[model samples]
Target: MSKHLLREISENIVKGDSIRTKQLVEQALEEFTPEVVIKEGLIPGMETVSARFQSCEFCLVDVVVAADAMQKGVQILKEKCRKEKAFAPKGRVVIGTVEGDIHDLGKNIVAVTLEGAGYEVVDLGVDVSPTQFVKAIAKFQPDLVCISALLTVTMLRMEDVIEAIKEAGLREQVKIIVGGAPVTQSFADKIGADAYVEYGTNVVYKADELLKKKGRRVALIQLPSILKEKHQEIFRKLFDFTPTFLDQNNRVILQGEELPECCRECREWNYEHNAEKTVVYSCPGGLSIIEARIEGDSIKLGKIICGPFLVETPGKVCVCAPGAKKVSSLELEKIAIFTQMIAEQIQIESREKLLQVQLEDQREILIRALKFQEELKNALNEARYRSLQSQVNPHFLFNSLNSLARLAMLEEAEKTEKFAYALSRILRYILRNIKSTVRIAEEIEIIRDYLFIQQVRFTDRLSVHLRIDEHIYDGLMPCMVLQPLVENAVVHGLEPLEREGMLEVSGERKGELVFFEIKDNGVGMSSDKLREISQLKISRSGRGHTTGLGLFNVHQRLQHYFGSNSGLEIQSQQNKGTSVKVFFPYIPQ
Candidate 1:
């Protein structure tokens, strides 16, 4: 009848029916204890919901609704227990997401699961910095602290939290657990966490296991010679009897041959080789006494035979023999329990060592991967920069050849020779500097050569002005940054105007940055064209008819070298003028 009521309560919680769950808890209180209701009813229901959520049978909204029901049910039980003075928390847990991470769904779920397991949980919510976690540790004094992060960027803060706790001298007081989407077991180990759980439901069991195994008391005994002088004190504390060893043939090796009459008789019987063929045996008074106990005698014997048990460290086999005093059943039970705890502790230590080795192997692999990724990124950037440089060089050469051909056709030999000389200088500059950056003075010399060629082509229709700050002559910039913008102004802005067009190039140093401006009083762009160019969506009507490719190429290279802050800014008014400003970091030569 009690089982049926508990099942109904569990089903209601799963259904997220809060009213029904509260009523069931109140009703169950009359029959079952609060501990029984929590363990059997609420916890089991939550476990089922968590399993469903992990399997994708339930979504976040469904889990939230179910958690609401669970919370309501727990609150009613807490109130009831408080009035009756029966509330006893299983353990205390502190949980939060690390600094810079605002994602908290996973952290919240784990916190609720710990609460459902009867732990007193203190939830420090999302974006909890390292200092906050250390402060909470001092205030809460929890058995476990859980750190969570969903992003790779924020996941590193878990290590900071751990180091803070260590610095605060609170590391030993609590066990730390870390988890999130980007978190792995190897990462947790690297950060010195106590345990890492991939799933929320597993947090409950792992927390319980860690708390139980940590700081446990066990009796340790040295081996090989069980009668060693150092072990004498431990033996005396655990047993009244002086222990003895037996070989595989069941021959008794007494502590000393100080013979009691019973031990002499027992050794004689064993010398006749009449002991039963078994792993362990209990000795009685002679062969007759052993047979009597096997036949259901309740007599207390003077000494009992125990063992064929194994001990770690230096391995050996040994049997135990009680002292001259009579052995009781309770004393035998104590001996059994003590040995068992030692065996369990050894197994736990062995598993931890194996896991540490695996974590180290994983850490090595991650380090190699990160190094390879950095190399690959550099290679891709170089390939992209070279590709952009290739496009600009060919386009400039074709236009210069066209200007030279027009002068040749007009039969002007002296002007043709001058144009050819300037073209040669520009070509020589581009060929020599295909790498990333060059001095501002060298770049300005190349720009002057380029503008001279354009001015010779346009003749009276083009006019030029230069305003350069002498202090900024040593600053560095990309190789061909100025040539493309100047070419655009001469070809699109000045060439289209019938009257004389003016082009101005200016440079100045502003704090850490060097600013260059190219202003032209000619045909400027419309709002649509300006917007299109700013977005790198230039139409065929723009300068060079290359669809903004040259501007885009220059912009990309600027950003690549000096980050996004150092790039082009363009302002233009149709039929009035256009001004293009370029920014570069002032790296002194």
Candidate 2:
């Protein structure tokens, strides 16, 4: 009976009824501890809210209402606990966005997630100064201090906060974590932070890892197949809305309508560029379409297409076709939730083999792609192309994508620019020289670029440290040599492992030789596997392997360029980590 009542309390919170929620909490307290009431009742509702928020079901207004209801229940619990003197929070946290940055959306999410996770959170609102942080650490005596900044320029305030804490002699009392739109693990390490996470959901798990020895796994997901009718059924049950699925080319494969002629004005709007959706976006036609892009690894596969539905019944808000479905604004909120779920499901299904095959195919193509450029261009124009080809208006897409990019730039231009340039530099370097020798500095610089990209992708999961002597920067090595080994360390070594990843790249010169190493604390290879790798050979190397460039290709090229002694020496033990050593004669460029 108490369990039944507790479930009702959760439901009421979801409905955002603070009055009824408080009354239910009063009833619940008679039969339950405040902790039980919080964990089993309030947290579940807020967790649902969080899930819905992630999916787009709940907007900021919805979240505020639900949070208010939750806080009402929490207040009642706090009073009860005070009377009993028996409430214990998991830990205390001090959270804020750093000074000079006012963004707090993510910070708000983190605070809420931590509270639900049983941490007592003290929120220091946006544009928080370093001295303010230092004071809070001293006053709250928190177990963790979380600093967030949405802009690259303001994120520097995190380092200042850390310095202030150190100056206050409060550094030893709390672990510090930094997060934001543009913050990276390299930046975190550079700023003397304890951890860096891409999303707020990771805070509790990450905090637990820092405070305790416990660990959590963060995995990547991709859609393996097209959406089916069954998935549409889910939307129907939840929102009285079924969806259409379209391929990348906007070719409708399932239940979908042709985009309204008015939507042509939005032709330059690219849905595939970002992980966000439009809710009840009205086209030039009186009818409206609700839509969300289906993306994998930042590529748009298709859209979970819905609508041409009415925002209001015909002849009310506006006239609609007699057969068109009418949807309420509240339902649009629900659609956000539905869209997020389908998109995540698409992403979470493991498509490792498919992606690997695609990677190999692209590598094989690119090495020879330049030679067949004209033919390929002709083929692309005449043959029709793309993973899921459907026609789209380039202008609408460019404008939409360009606008989104501008918004992101407005928030964090420095980091965005850095990533774009880094990728450009790496791609340009890869294409220019496949069969040529290059300076060690060139290899190291590209590796840094590669790692920077990985750091952004993996966030808290990957941390790197590089130590190189100036002596080897100008030394010669085959082009694209070291990057593959480093890539191997990341993909084969660190990525598959369950724990946090640690990567180390070091190079130094000794006498007549230059020694370079790529090491990872990941799920290492077995002795037999190591021996097999040792014996592996490249049939013919033009550019690179299973990934982009194979380890054997690098080894074979190094030996060919220098001597037998100048190749790779790998040592590994399963569940431990792997280290690959590269040594060659000190040949200057």
Candidate 3:
């Protein structure tokens, strides 16, 4: 009879019949335990919804409605579970969209999916700044943090959040997961996120994996044999320092070396204070180590050295290279990840021995670990890519310097000095405002400088005119915004022409929007070329030199910073002229 009721409950949930689901929950509670009803009915129903959603049998709206039905049923079951003392959450998660972005559709779906997976979720909603995430971490003390950003502009804030977590000394305590349309696994790795979920439903599995890795432990007696030959290699190559294990009495079990003086002091303090939670400390030699208490045992995990520099308290794991003067937070995070993997292997061995699991299951575990290792390798490669992107492009700098030298050699003292000043201003602005916005007026000034340099190079063959409203000068926009458009206009539209070329730069305010137009009378593109550029089908080399790259980057930045409606509109005709108009919501300082 209860099985029949459970089946009915699952059907109602799939159908998104909230009223019927609630009614069925109440009826089931009268006959069966809340644990049974939740385990057999609500969980299965949500799983079916997730499966259908993944399979494309159910749309986003359908899944959302189904989730609502499931939530209602869970709410009713919660009371019964509490009364019966059978309530248990799968995990705890704190989630939010990054600052400067208000899109919540993707975030909502992830939150609901996590909740359906039996996680106690703390939803921070949208436009969540780095400080807010830090505060939430301190308060909620969640096992995981999921950050969402739909726009590329806002996606950059994820790095800021990770930095804030490190500053607050809580980076090691929780796992971070990032997702959204613009977010990629590479970006996640670059931002030092623990995991990246390509699909919303995958969040559940990733979260589970992270939690398992965190709670994983290995007894000292079982460590060496469990890891076999890979054990020594991991400690020496990854951790730098030897691995040490301690028993309840503070006696060394797997002897490696005496604890560093600072680590010894921390251990003494922990013993004196009866510290139960994990503690992280840095030694006088500038090595970072973490000490965590093993659950249900007197044995404690000793301070595992991460790298040469000390990370602040509360970060879960630290990864860094040995003999380095300074270690980046991201590098430390990688060390922490590898440490968890090692610990996971230890835990797996323990499980195999205790549960006597099949040989196939052991092989499966090994395969999963290998897959994780591949992910780590990819993340490291992406980290290197991010490092490259952070530096100024040498080619551009070299070209600008050459142009300035040419002007100096021509005895054009005024032009040389002006070009040097403009180049300095541009580089200085980029360096100072890598993660910030600037006023439109400030951007316009940079654009004027940039155009001046181009005008001098082209001499009488090039001319530019600027007409901007003073009233809208204080409107805020991303840094280096206008300069790219101006550069694209001159390089792609004006420089190719042999005859006189005219460029017009203008701005105005209309209602709630601010518009800027860059018009050039040079070599206008044909209709087919325009269409190809619009569709982003033309490669960088195919679209003439810097034109395609600069234009595409600027268009993407505009749309990311403002909205989809706020981007470049290209109007051109072959051999006539090209006009690129950009607009965004008027946001006053």
Candidate 4:
């Protein structure tokens, strides 16, 4: 449970869930020491956010929010850090953004990353002048001085700050490292700074070098082995949301949802620098979505995208609103971090699965599977044998009927021959489809044989209609489903009626499902009787039956295979009519 909490803490931090981070840090504190929480959760998450920023997979906004979440968590663990000595403060460092450049996102990230690494970070806010740098040095006598700048013009201030520390005679007391978007290694050398750093996490190694310190101050975070493919499915399970995508060509990659994604051409937006853009697309349904693109260095390397979220909820919800979820702006920032992490994790896992397997393990797994092959085959055969034993024999009845049909045809009794042929066809259909699924078209043929036999028997009193749509003819359903209801309509409903009996079997394809109805006009059942049939407490025939498959048996099978959305529904009025409507998933083979 502690390990799970640690994972959640790391995830929440990556998600920029700051309010929840503070709570998680406190809960984790009860199970783990402050150092353990920071190392296992806070530092790893912040490092991931920073790396994404450097890779251009995350914009400044994502890093800033993730850093803010880390800061909130660190604030909770501050006092405890003063008590524990495992990850005691390594050194005191004064860090801030340079003068005339108001960007402190870089500085805050550096401070938080360093602090999470067990350094005592004295963040002197943003826009610190050269005098402030020297003043901070005089007061703290820090081991290192880190200055940041985000613009070309303000980066020169780093040199001025270094010069002031020299003039104040504090140069020998501390090492100065220069870093920012505009600061380069050559620029750092020209400015006489001790070291130039690019990534915030890399700064820890550089700081250790500048101070001649040793012994692994920071731990690198690696995704676990369980991380695998199904990147889209994993994200949906984790966040209760579906994510959309864009291909390498920068075109919207679609998955055929009811809601359409933006289908702009590749040339419309440049993919070269898309890694830096915060994409929030407005869908055709007027719902806003957040997206992050993680592309490989080569064209063959694919991208993991995160979107399918609304910026804000709609006043009048979209007809396709279920496809896109709503999230806060801060939660959206965390997605950029998470999208890149999972994308890289899956790619890494895919490569590692092949490389890390041993010959002995592979051979053992193959040998074990082969050893069980015969047992598996025997078990399947035994199960099928048991299933066959539970059902009544239909072959003997079919053979005897076939002989009677031949004799009737020889005697020139046309009605007798046709009735026996229809009965034989129904029995053959039952035998063939008993254990397998059947298309509507195939199932309808058996129903036709059943109605034919009944029509011949009742002649003037019976009337039947089949208004089936050809569109649903190819849709699949459980075998022996429609015929049972047709048998019930003919045997129980029509046979008991004094007036002309009427029956209808109609089915049609509606969207992803097919709707089927077996309605009858006869001596209709009462409301209480309808309830009893629906509740599975009574059989429609009470004892004598056509096929052994009852209404309840068909109902149970429908629910078992297709879920609760399917199964039997009985509606009737005393002496009026009864209708059994059924609906289930429709998949055409």
What TM-score against the true fold does each predicted structure earn?
Answer: 0.34, 0.31, 0.39, 0.36
Angstrom error of the Cα, residue 560, model 1: value is 1.8
Model 4 lDDT on a 0 to 1 scale = 0.70
**Candidates sorted on TM-score, descending:** 3, 4, 1, 2
Tens-digit lDDT track of model 3 for 338-393: 55555555555655653453354345444544564566589889999986885657
Candidate 3, residue 311: Cα displacement in angstroms equals 78
Best by TM-score: 3
**Weakest 10 consecutive residues of candidate 3 by summed lDDT:** 267-276
lDDT of 1 by residue, 280-390 (tens): 233433121111001001111112233312222133212332333344445544554443343233334434543564466445434543454465579889989988888
Alpha carbon deviation, residue 12, candidate 1 (Å): 53
- Which residues of candidate 2, in runs, are more than 4 Å off? 1-412, 537-547
Better of 1 and 3 by TM-score: 3
Give one clash count per candidate, in the order shown.
1, 15, 5, 0
For 1-589, candidate 4 gives per-residue lDDT tens digits of 9888988888887889999999998999898866577668877787787788889998555665787788788777765554553665778899988865566655765666666567887888777888788767766758899999865645767888888766655675678888987688999999998889886657778876766531111101112232333656767677766565444444444341234333332122222222353455554444544455443322222344555456554554445455566776567657656766665665565445434443443454345444444555788899899777745567878888899999999999988998898898888887777778888898998899899988988988999999999988888888988898888888888899999999999998776667889999978798787756644357433332766788656754675566434545678877788898888778887
Query: Stretches of candidate 4 above 4 Å error?
Result: 1-393, 539-544
lDDT for model 2, please.
Answer: 0.71
Give the per-residue Cα lDDT of candidate 1 at 224: 22
Per-candidate RMSD, Å: 20.2, 30.7, 21.9, 35.9
Candidate 1's error at 502, in angstroms?
0.7
CA displacement after TM-score superposition, residue 333 of candidate 2 (Å) = 99
Where does candidate 3 clash, by residue pair? 172-315, 172-316, 318-336, 319-332, 319-335
